[model samples]
Target: MGREELVRRVSEFAKESEETILNQVRKMGSSLDWSRYAYTLDEKRASAVSHAFVNMYEAGLIYRGHRIVNWDPKGQTTISDDEVVYEEENGKFYYFQYGPFVIGTARPETKFGDKYVVINPNDTRYKEYEHGQQIELEWINGPITATVIMDEASDPEIGSGVMTITPWHSVVDFELAEKHDLDKEQIIDKYGKLLPIAQEFEGMKITEAREKIVEKLNKKGLLVKVDEKYTHNVSKSERTGATVEPQIMEQWFVAVDKPFKIPHSEIKGVKSGDEVTLKQLMRTAVESRDIEMSQNGFRKTYFHWIDNLHDWCISRQIWFGHRIPVWYKGEDIYCGNDAPDGEGWEQDPDVLDTWFSSALWTFSTLGWPEKTKDMETFHPNAFMSPAYEILPLWVSRMILMSSFHLGQVPFKKVLIHGLVRDKSGRKFSKSLGNGIDPLDLVSEYGADAVRMGLLVGTAIGNDINFDESKVKGYKHFANKLWNITRFILENHHEGVPKTLPDKAIGYLDELKHIVAEITTEMEKYHLYLASEKLYHYIWHRVADQILEETKEVFASDEEDAKIAMSHTLNIILTTSLKLLHPFMPFVTETIWQELPQKDEDMLMIAKWPHTKD
Candidate 1:
């Protein structure tokens, strides 16, 4: 399909998918305000994204440069480092003779791009090969001259204590080439085929070229040996499942290490006039404890990523994202919120990376770049809960963008959660045919039961091995709660009393203690602990003990004892419904509607019961 047709179709599909997702969220009882909902591609969000890009560009933090980036050959786009998935695979390590030196490499196909042979400066084995010594390498393609460079970064322990530099194909070699001002050659095309420099191997795929080149090298007596059991990590694109090729490309990037004056900042020890880099802004947000993580160990992971941060490639060769708000009129370039007045300018064909727009989600959803009530009230969100896998991809970028634009962290605290896997600890996937549809479970068991089952035993930042039995158990728990409520309502008096009678005072006190404990657990973000406590208290204490005792009291002929029993039952039923509303909203709300005494129109807005009350 053409680019325009593809974009139109994708946009329609996105809208339909979004509506389907929103309907599911409503069916699952989410409390989000539909009136304030916003999409990343909406006009307001697109404006906010363009405004952010222009501002950052003017601040010198965003630049267009040629640098090595993760290139997804299948997607035909440049992806960020976070989008690359590394997998360990068995491969062969080939040792090839290069004139006087023998070097080891896993990829013989990239040898055509080798520009330098680097050796450790302290390695006595290559001491005779002085720095800048010229030597002719008997390459499979033909004879090529390479300079011997001495550098301490080269490992003397690996391979033959020497390594060939393929600057355009490797990140380390690119950095080394920049450090030593060495030349770079491009031997791999964007389609992963050999370039014209490979001669007979030209136009061959990288895999095919590797086999053919090895055979040629062995025929030429240049192949030393090969290790068949060599295992190494290969980077693959997360989106297309294609091997990621590190290539030099001119793309728009966010300069993470470039210092820019803080336009505004709300973080402690950081002021508007202070100068800091994007890396520092993200690091300070977590390091200063302004944004606490759910799991303390993830803080170390966040710091390690920031310490080794690289310039972010924010451009993508895709048709379905926010088009970069940049125009070119021959040599003249213009970047702004809107297109320039001239008719001769053509806008950039590529779009900005998806994360570039998502980074502005917290504030942009509240009408950023335009002063508004929502921005003032909700810009600094209180909390954010996302999967731990995106700690660097989405979370860190949100912090960096918020700090730069709004001068504060996006949220005060982040609760890192984990993926839900099958019972055998395998991730849910279509190919595996093990994916569980929550809607199907909600259909079998009530929505409240499914919600309770998910939260009952799951801890923060821990993967859930979802068991259908847990949902079945919670389904039974819901039935028990409904039956208990029915019995209490059937036996209770018409009007709720102002205070409990003396005989019911003990039950009231015990209820107060349980409420206090559950409230404390919930405040600490211990949802699992709170759910477990509520499950036990309601099943064992209320239904088993209190109801049995109340039954005897109701059977008495004494009028005062009966009234006290009915009043205590009413209080316990109402209080428990309120406590359980968060976990089992649908069932609790249904029960709340049947009660005679209710303070709010909806149970969601009902005042929480206090221990003193």
Candidate 2:
């Protein structure tokens, strides 16, 4: 279908999801201005990203070169260092022969039709074979012979005393090819098409090739013996579970080591010495650290990732995303510091990783290249709220990239919340079918109710268990607030009292104190504390005490009662909306607009309540 049709379908889908969608929209009201919203696919967002890239390129950070990369054939994309997932599996080591030498492979099937096997020369059994001559390739039963390349990953006692080499399917081969300057014979194109050299196996599916080649080798009497059921680690494509082909190909790369400082160690000392800006850099580094470093040493678990970080690969072979701006002119290529001017070069078809664009989200969302008003005030906003799952993926990268380009952390504070788990503490996943539909929850419980429910028991960096009972409880609290507001409106519709009574003096000061604390906590990225404080203030102080105590006064004396009632109503309504703004932005916005107020006012840009001088 066409692009317009797709957009329409998605819009309609969202529209059909009424109660939940409206609630979420209301929850997100203050933190996000819907009028200025930009999705990744929006052209305005693309234009902003285009500008950010040019600025970074001109600053001499973006460059290109050939490097080893993770390729996902299903998505036709290349992911960065952070995207790869490694898992261990079971396989067998094959003990076989080539004319007169022994070979071993975790993938016994891969040894089929092999012309070479690499044996470490130090292994006494093959020391005499030196340069591809005959050696008795006898196992307990038979013989094999193939060329050997020396490597230590092989065990002399395992199978054939030699590790097999398949440049077409392994990372070990890629490294060895570079060391020997060997011409790589990996003949599969990115599209899984066979190159001319793979003639016999050309046009065969990789799976088909595996089966046919193994059968041919068995028929030719090349098979010596097989060891069944070996457990080992195998590299699978991150996007697709298909076995990865590590064929050599020219691919783009960025040297991430330039921006990262590897910790000092005995074998490798990476400190920059006098040139390093450790003091200022340390401040930014500490900011990225847990605000209050976990007492249980959780940061230690996070160390392995930061300690041995690799230079990232940002280019991807995809039609979507921001395409790398570099262009090629024959053997030499040109990197564009600006949008390519009319020239003879063909732009690189590859797009950058999706994270690359999102790395600029904090600033690009605020007009990065040119200094706009929003850039000046909120470009470096007070804080950032991110789900804890992305701490390693998006948070760390954003900090590094923002520090590199803007000389500041993207946000002063990082507020992280854990995933919403089931009551049994198991993480919700699609495959397990334990996942709760957020829209369904929002429909049943209003947006504000659902948000409050999520944060009720969740501390910073803590997981929340989903319980519909808790959601209904919060919905009941929301109903209390609505009914209480209705009662206040019936008693008093005028503005807050100009003068305070001796009895109300203490309560007014308490109200002011709560507002100040909520404002401080919200600015510091402590939304949970802020929400709870507002809930406490409304339910206890206003609903129970103020309404009950002031009822008799309103019945007997109208003016004085109106003053006290209006004062309490205004405070509760404004504070509730402000506290609820980030989590349930849309509903808060709707409630804000419906409040007794002036025309032409937008709830989102309203000044966050601050402490009095």
lDDT: which candidate is best?
Answer: 1
TM-score of 1: 0.97
How far out, in Å, is residue 292 in model 2? 9.7
Instruction: Write candidate 1's Cα lDDT for 1-613 as tens digits.
Output: 8999999999899989998888779878898888998999999999999999999999998999999999999999999989999999999999989888898899999988686899999999877888999997678767888898999878988777889889999999999999998888888999999999888999999997887899999999999999999999999998899999999999999999998789777896688889899999898888888888748777788899899889999999888999999999999999999999968999999999999999999999998889999888886899999898899999999999999989989999998888889999998988899987778988999899889888988998899899999999999999999889888878876544566666589888999998999999999999999999999999988998889888877777866667667878888888998999999999999889998776787899999989988
TM-score for each prediction? 0.97, 0.68
Where does candidate 2 have its weakest 10-residue lDDT segment? 262-271
lDDT of 2 by residue, 509-582 (tens): 67678878877886665777877877777788778887788777677756865676567656656766665566
Candidate 1 colliding pairs: 265-407, 266-407
Q: Rate residue 530 of model 2 by lDDT.
A: 79
- Per model, how many backbone clashes are there? 2, 23
User: lDDT of each structure?
Assistant: 0.89, 0.61
The parts of candidate 1 lying over 4 Å away from their true place are: 494-503
